[model samples]
Structure formats: C-alpha cells, structure tokens
Target chain A: EAGVTQSPTHLIKTRGQQATLRCSPISGHTSVYWYQQALGLGLQFLLWYDEGEERNRGNFPPRFSGRQFPNYSSELNVNALELEDSALYLCASSLAAGQGKPLHFGNGTRLTVT
Target chain B: GESVGLHLPTLSVQEGDNSIINCAYSNSASDYFIWYKQESGKGPQFIIDIRSNMDKRQGQRVTVLLNKTVKHLSLQIAATQPGDSAVYFCADYLTGFQKLVFGTGTRLLVSP
Candidate 1:
C-alpha cells in the first residue's frame, strides 16, 4: 500500500515570504496532522484536520495555518516566514482522532527560511 | 509546558545486545503512548504502542513498557542490529485531544 506523500521535498524561503507545504494521506485515512521538527528539537504539533474541518491546533501563531481537502489531503501555509521557521514539516494520517491508531508519516518537506 | 521527554540523548550498544530506551511523560490523562523510530532524513516509523489500560505491548523484536505509577515509558529492542541505529521517540496522547506530544528522542547507535 502507498504511504503518505508530501510535495516539494525541500523548500527555501526568505524572511517575510510565504511558504506552502502539501500532504496526501494514506488511501483510507481520514485524519491529517502537521508537525514541525526543528534542528535539535522534538516534533512540535502544528495542526490537525479531520472530516474537512480544522479539529485542533498547536501553540503556533496564526501565520501557521492549513486545511484538509475532501479527499483527506492537507496543506500547511506559513506566512511571514522567519529564520526560526526553518524546519522539517511532517504530515501524518491515521484512522481517526478517537481510534488511538498509529499514524503513518510522510518523509516530510524540509523548509529553510533565510 | 509539560511534555514527554527521554532519559538520555544518546545510547550506544553492541550488535546482538539488548537495548533499552527510556522516556518520562507528565500527562497522566494521556490514554495512548507510542514509540517511533526515525532514520536519517526519514520520518518517524511506528515501532509499537500501548494503551493506558495496558502495561505492555510487544512487536517483532520490540517491546514497550508503560509504568503509569511513575509516569514512565520504555522501549526494549532485543538483539540489536546496526540497522537499529536511529533516533527513537516516545509520544503520548489523549483520545479526542487531537494532538500527539513527542519527546526530544534518544539516538541509539549499534556497533557491529
């Protein structure tokens, strides 16, 4: 079976610019998750989308936003990017929020802000 | 903020030896605890998971032990191999919370 897939394996942006990352969940998964893995840091939750709605969010600023499509794919948009925003943005999917199932992750999009 | 964390940043072991990576979580309300293995340039892969009601779960060559009493979690790999060298992370979540809190991770190195 195909796993979660991410687009533009690498992204380079400048401060004040905007960057968008995309993710396609597994064939049957309905919940999508976005996480940020900074240098020497753990994975920080970004957003959660389920059933085409924004179900939950992290502590990040409003500049970090995303949406889930009808097909369960997701897109993360970071506006007014800063140097500290450079990190590996990961996307994951699973059965659902209440299922307590393991999440399948994409290799991730490496975003480097200058 | 309270979150899951590892006891060590790195661990070195010899091939054929048993390896144990430990983690501590502060969220007693978390209903699910999981372990992930991440290799260089790759996303984390699910190693195993255990529900709060259960104390242990075992997979192919991995075992996860949850000690709710002390709010601790541990992953054990038997007969560790060089391929097992990677960053292992422990994460916890509460059902319906919609967020998985991951630890800083422990880099396990296996020498053949």
Candidate 2:
C-alpha cells in the first residue's frame, strides 16, 4: 500500500501572501494530522482531523488552518504568510485517533516565504 | 506546560557501535510514546513505540524503553550504520488527545 503522499513538494510565496499545501492519506486511514518543522526545530503539531471533523489543534495561530476531506485527504492553508512560516509542512495519517497507532507521514511540502 | 524534550541535542557514534538516545517527558498522563527517525529533507519515519503498560519494546535492531516512574524514554540502536544518521524525535500522546507532542530532536551521526 502507498504511504501518505504530499503535493507541491516545494512552494514559494511572498510575505503576506497565502499558501496551500495538500496531503493524501493512506487507504483505510481515518485520521489526518498536519505538522510544521521549522529549521533547527522539532515537529510542531498544527491540526488534527478525524472523520472530517477538526479534532484538535496546537499553539499555532488561526492563520494556520486546514481541513480533512471525506477521502481522508487534507489541505493546510496558511494565510498572511510570514517569513518565519518558511518550513517543511508535514501530513500524517493514522488508522484512528487515540489508539496509539503509529502515524505514517508524507515526505512534506517545503514552503518558502520570501 | 507539559512537554517532551530530549536529553541531548546531538550524538555521534562509530559504525558497529550501539547508540542510545534519551528523552524526558513532563506529562505523566501520557500513556503512549513513539520514536521517529527523520532523514534530511524527509518526513519522520516511525522507528518504534511503547505504551505505558510496557516497559520495553524491540524492533529490528532497535529498542524503545519507557520508564513511566521517572517519565523517561530511550531509543537504542544496535550496530549502528551510516544510514541511521538523522534526527530522532520522541513523541508523547495523551490518552484523550489526538495529536502527538514531539520532543526536541537528537541528531545522530554515525561514522565509519
């Protein structure tokens, strides 16, 4: 089976612009999560969507939002992007939430805000 | 205020040697933990995981030990290889929460 897949491997946007990244979860997975990995920093959880509902979110601002589609694919939209927003945005999928199931992650989309 | 952090920022080891990376978590309520290996420009790959009910779990050439008493977790790789060079992160999952809180990563370097 294919693992999680992300599109637009690399994206470039100017400050104050908007950026959108996409991810498709593995088949049979019901939970999709978005994370941001800044240079020299750890993975920061952004959003969690389960069964098409926003389940949880991290410390990121409202500008960082996303949604999961019925097919379990997800899209992360960063509005008013700042230079600091330049980082690798990763998406992961799990069989379900709260099951302790290991997450399968996508290679990630590197967003560069200039 | 609860967070997961790594004991070290970097670890260097020679090929064929055993390598151990340590992490400490502040949330005692965290019942599940995972170790992830992230290669350069790639997403984190699941190395192994352990639950609160278990003290140790083993995978192919890798072992994860969870000490809930002290809220510590460690990942041990046997006969380390150059391919093992990457950043390793330990994450904790609170029982009711859907997201995983990741720790500051430990960069592992393997030398021949």
Candidate 3:
C-alpha cells in the first residue's frame, strides 16, 4: 500500500499572502493530521481531521486551518502567511484517531514565505 | 507550557556501537509514547512506541524503554550504522487526545 502523499514538494509565497498545501492519506486510512516542522525544531501539531470533521487543533492561530474530504485527503490553508511560516508542513494518516496507532507521514511540503 | 524535552541536543557515536537517546516528558497523563527518526528534509518515520503499561519494547534493532515513575523515555539502537544518522524525537499522546506533543529532538551522528 502507498504511504501518505503530499503535493507541491516546495512552495514559495510572499508575506501576507495565502498558501494551500494538500495531502492524500494511505489507502483505508480514515484520520489525517497536519504538523509543522520549523528549521531545527521539532514537529508541532497543527490540526487533526477524522471522518470529515475537525477533531482537534494545536495552539496555532486561527489563520492555520484545514479540512479533510470524504476520501480522507486533507488540505491545509495558511492565511496571512508570515516569514515564520516558512517550514516543512507534514501530513500523517492513521487507521483511526485516538487509538494509539502509529501515524504514517508523507515527505512533507516545504513552504517558504518570503 | 509543559512539553517533552530531550536530555541532550546531540549525540555522537561510532559505527557498530550502541546509541541511546533520552527524553523527559512533563505530562503525567500521557499514556502513549513514540520514537521517530527524521532524516534531512524528510518527515518523521516511526521507530517504535510503548504504552504506559509497558516498561520496555523492542524492535528489530531498536528498543524503547518507558519509565513512568520518573516520566522518562529512551530509545536505544544496536550496532548503529551510518544510515542511523538523523534527528530522533519522542512524542507523547494522551489517552483521549488526537494530538501528539513532540520532544525537542536529539541529533544522532554516527562516525566510521
């Protein structure tokens, strides 16, 4: 089976602009999660979507939002992007949410905010 | 503000040697813990995981030890190889939560 896949391996956007990143979960996976990995920093949880609903989110601002489609694919949208937003955005999928299942991650989309 | 943190920022070990990375978590309620290896420009790959009820778990060449008493977790790699050079992270998940709180991370360097 294919692992999680992310689109736009690299994306560049100007400050104050909006950026959108996409993810496709592995086959038969129902939960998708988004995380941000800043340079030399650890992964920071962004959002969690399960069964087409937003189940949880991290301490990030409302400008960082995303949605999961019925097929379990997800899209993360960053509005009013700031320079600090330049980082690798990762997408992960699990068989289910809150089940202690190990998440499978995609290579990630490297977003550069200029 | 409580989060998971590593005991060291970086660890250097020789090839064919054993390597151990340590992490401390502040959330006592966290019941599930995972260790991930992330190479340059790549997402984290799951190395292994252990639950609160378990003290130690072993994989092919990796071992995870969880000490809930002192809230410490560790990952040990046997006969480390060059490919093992990467940043390793420890993450904790609460029983009913969907989010994972990651540790600062430890960079492992293997030298021949």
Candidate 4:
C-alpha cells in the first residue's frame, strides 16, 4: 500500500499571491487531512475532508481552504498568502475521521512565501 | 485561545538513555491523545496514542502516559537512539470532535 503523497515538494510564492498544494491519500483511505507546520512550530490542523465533504476546519482564516476529490485526493489552497504562510504543508490520511486511528502523513510540500 | 503547549522547548539525552517529553493541554474534554515524531523537513509521523480511558499505553520502545486530572501528557522513549533526534508533538482530540489540538512541540536531541 502506498503512503500518502504530496505534490510540489517545494514551492515559492510571493506575498499576496495564491498557493495550491495537492495530496493523494493511501489507496483505501477515505479521509484526508491538511495541516500546516510553520518553522519552529507544531502541526496546526487546517482542514479535514471526509466522503467528499469538509467535516471540520481549524481556527485558520477562510484564506486557508481545501477540498477532497472523489478519489480521496485533496488540494489545499492558500489565498492572499502572507510571509507567515511559509511553512511545510502536510497531508494525512486515516481510515476515517475521528475513528481513533493513526494517520499516515506525506513528506509535505514546503511552501515559501516571499 | 485554547491550545496545547510543551513544557520544554528542547530535551537532550544520551544515546541508550531514556527520554521523556511533557505536554499540557488546556481542553479537559480532550479524550484522545497522540504523540508524533517529525524529522527535519518532513511531515509528522505517528508514534503512539492513548485514550482517556487508559492512563498508560506502550509501543515498541515508546510509552504514552495520560493524566486526565491535570490534563497532562507525556511520551517516554526507552533507549533513545540517534535516529530519535527530532521534534515530538502531542496532539489532543476534542471531545466528540475530529479536530486535533497540537502542542508547540519539543526538540529531542540524543547525543552519542
């Protein structure tokens, strides 16, 4: 079984621009989660998509949004990106949301907002 | 305004020694807790997890202890190795919610 996979291992965007990151969950996983890991900070939950619907989101602003596709892949979009948005964007997959199962994470897309 | 935080910014231990990282959570209602290991430039990896109903849970060489009374959590790594040098984060699942609250994380350094 392949693990979670993320696109654009590294990305660079200017301030006020938009950044889009992608993720592909494990073969049989149905839930995809997005997290932001800023430098010197912990992983902050961004969004959770299950069954093609967003089940939950974190305290982040509306600028941070994402969607899950029919195939269980996910895309995280950051609009009006700020310098603080430079961080590692992680994607994880679980059997389902809140099922108390361990999440498998991808290497993450390192976004650098200039 | 609610969150989880680490008591220490960093921890240094000798190889073959045991290491313990501590975390404090503000949400008393959090029922599920997880410990994750994140390597440099990589994503966070699941180390282990424990539920509110259990006080202690053990993995191969890792152990998680949860103290619901004080809303404290700890991860103990036995015989720490060089590969264990990374950041450890403790995440708490809100009661009846799927969102996970994560801590600031602690950097573990195992010196040979």
Candidate 5:
C-alpha cells in the first residue's frame, strides 16, 4: 500500500498571500493530520480531520485551517502567510481517530515565504 | 496544559555505539507515546511506540521504554550508524482526540 503522499513537494509565496497544500492518505486510512515543522523546531500540530469532520486543532491561529474529504485526503490552507510560515508542512494518516495508532507521514510540502 | 519535552538538545555518539534519547511528558493521562526520526528536509518517520500499559517495545534495532510512574520515555538505538543521525521527537497521544503532542526533539549525530 502507498504511504501518505503530499503534493507540490515545494511551494513559494509572498507575504500576505495564501498557500494551499494537499495530502492523500494511505488506503484504508480514515484520519488525516497536518503538522508544521519550522527550521530548528519540532513538529507543531496544526489540525486533525477524520471522517470528513474537523476533530481537533493545535494552538495555531485560525489562519491555519484545513479539512478532510470523504476519501480521507486533506488540504491545509495558510492564509495571510507570513515570512515565518516558510517551513515544511507535513501530512500524516492513521487507521482511525482516537485509537492511538502510529501516524504515517508524507515527505511534506516545503513552503517558502518570500 | 500538556506538554512533551526533551532532556537534551543534541546527542553525539560514535558509530557502532548505542544512543539513548529521553523525553518527559507532563500529562499523566497520556497513555500512548511514539518516537519519530526526521531527517533534514524531510518528514518524521515512525520509529516505535509504547503504550502506558507496557514498559518497553522493540522494533528492528530500535527500542522504546516508557515509565508512566515518572512520566518519562526513552528511545534506544543499538549499534547506531551514520544513517541513524537525525532529529528524534517523542510524541504523546491525547486521549479523546486525534492529536499527538510532540516534544522539541533531540538531534542525534553519529560520528564515524
């Protein structure tokens, strides 16, 4: 089975612009998670969607939002992007929600804010 | 508030040696923990995980140890190699949610 896959391996945007990243979960996975990994920083949880509903989010601002489709694929949107937004946005998938399953991650979309 | 944190910023170990990374969590309610290895410019890869009910879990050349009593977790790599060099993060599963809180991460540098 294919692991989690992310589109736009690399993206570039100017400050104040918007950026969208996509992720496709593995087959049979129902939960998709978004995380941000900044330079010299750890993975920061962004959002969690399962069964087509937003289940949870991290301390990030509302500008960082995303949704999961019926097929379990997910899209992460960053609005009013700042220079600090330049980082690797990772997408992970699990078997289901609230089951403590290990997450399978995508290589990630490297977003560069100019 | 719940937080997972690492005890070291970086660890340097000689090749063929064993490396241990430590993490401490603030939430006793957390029952699941995971270790992730992230290479530069790449996403984190799952190493291994251990639930609160178990003290240890082994996979390949990696092992994860959990001590719920002290809310501590550790990852040990046997016969570490250069390919094992990366930033390792410890994550704790939040109950009732699909979220996992990750620690700051520890940079593992294998010196040949």
Candidate 6:
C-alpha cells in the first residue's frame, strides 16, 4: 500500500504571506496529524484531525490551522507567515486516534518563508 | 510541561557495531513510546515502539527498552550500517492526549 504522500515538496513564500500544505494518508487510515520540524529541533505537533473533526492542537498560534477533508486528507494552512514559520511540515496518519497505534508519516513539505 | 527530550545530540559508531540512543520524558502519564528514523530531507519513519507495559521490544535488528521508573527509553540497533545513519527521535504519547510529543532527536553517524 502507498504510504502517506505530501504535495509541493518545496514551497517558498514571503513574510506576511500564507502557505498551504497538503497531505494524503495511507489507505484505511482515519487519523491525520500535522507537525512542524524546525532546524536543529524536534518535530512539534501542530494539529490533529480524526474523523473529519479537529480533535487537538499544539501550542502553535491560531495562524497555524488545518482541516481534514471527508476523504481523510488534510490541509495545513499557515497564515501571515513569519520568518520563523519556515520549516519542514510533516503529515502523518494512523489507523485511528486509539492508543498504541503508530503513525505513518510522509516525506513532508519544506516551507520556506523569506 | 509535557515534553520528551534526548540526552545526546549526536553519536558516532563504526559499521557492524551497535548503536544506542537515549530519551526521557517528563509526563508520567505517557504510556506509549516510539522511535523514529529520519534521513536527510525526509520525514521520520517508524523504527520501533514499546508500550509502558513492556520492558523491551525487538524488531529486526533494533530493540527498544522502556523504563517507567526513570521515564527513560533507549533504542539499540545491532550491526549498525551506514544506511542506519540518520536523525533518530523518540516520542511519547498519553492514552487520551491524542498526540505524540517528540524529543530533540539524536543524529547517528556510522562509519564503514
């Protein structure tokens, strides 16, 4: 089966602009998650969507928002992007929000804010 | 604060040797732990995971040991190869938290 896939492998946007990243989970997966990986840092959880509803989110600002589509795909939107917003955005999927399930991640979208 | 963190920023080992990466978490409620391997310009891939109920779990050439007493976890890779060189991260998750908290990550360097 195909793994999680992300689009626009590389994205460059100026400050104050908005950036959108897309992700498709593996088949039969229902939970989609977003994470931001900054240089020299670990992955920071951004958002979580399960069953088409926003279930949980990290400490990121409201400018960092996303939604899960009916098909279980997810879109992460970063509005008013700042220079610090530049990072690799990763998408992952799991069988469900249940405990003990490992997440399968995609290659990620490299978002560069200039 | 709920956070997972690595003890080492980098580790260098020779090929065919064993590699060990360590991590710790602050949240005692975290019952599940996972280790991930990420290559350059790529997202993290699942390597191995061990629940709080297990002291050790093995997969392929990798072993994950979890110690709830110290809130510590370790990933041991046997016969390390150059291909095993990458940034390895440990993550923790609570049963109802619905999200996994990741550590700072440790870069593993293997020399042939």
| DockQ, candidate 5, vs. native dimer | 0.52
- The CA lDDT of each predicted structure is 0.91, 0.91, 0.91, 0.88, 0.89, 0.91
Please give the lDDT score for candidate 4.
Answer: 0.88
Ranking by DockQ: 6, 1, 2, 3, 5, 4
Structure candidate 3, residue pairs in collision: none
The sequence of per-residue lDDT tens digits that candidate 4 reaches over residues B16-107 is 99999999998888888889898987888899999899999999999999999998999999999999999888988886678777888888
Computed on C-alphas against the true complex, the DockQ of each candidate is 0.54, 0.53, 0.53, 0.51, 0.52, 0.57
Better of 1 and 2 by DockQ: 1
When only the first chain is scored, the TM-scores of the models are 0.97, 0.98, 0.98, 0.97, 0.97, 0.98
Clashing pairs in 5: none
Name the runs in model 3 displaced over 4 angstroms: B1-8
lDDT by residue for model 2 over B7-94, one digit each (tens)? Answer: 4488999999999999998888898999999998899999899989999999999999999989999999999999999989999987
lDDT score for residue A32 of model 5: 92
lDDT by residue (A20-108, candidate 6, tens digit) is 99999999999999998876578889999999999999999999999999999999999999999988899999998877999999999
**Alpha carbon lDDT at B94, candidate 3:** 65
Two-way DockQ contest, 4 vs 6, winner: 6
Docking class of 3: medium
lDDT of 3 by residue, B25-91 (tens): 9889999999999999899999999989899999999999999999999999999999999988899
Cand. 6 TM to true fold: 0.96
lDDT of 1: 0.91
Clashing pairs in 2: none
- Could you give candidate 2's per-residue lDDT for residues A11-64 as a string of tens digits? 999999999999999999999999998776788889999999999999999999
For model 3, chain A alone compared with the true chain A gives a TM-score of: 0.98
Off by over 4 Å in 1: B1-8
**Alpha carbon deviation, residue B65, candidate 1 (Å):** 0.7
Cα lDDT of model 5 by residue, A1-114, tens digit: 888999999999999999999999999999899988776667888898989999889889999998888888989999999998999899999988774699989999999999
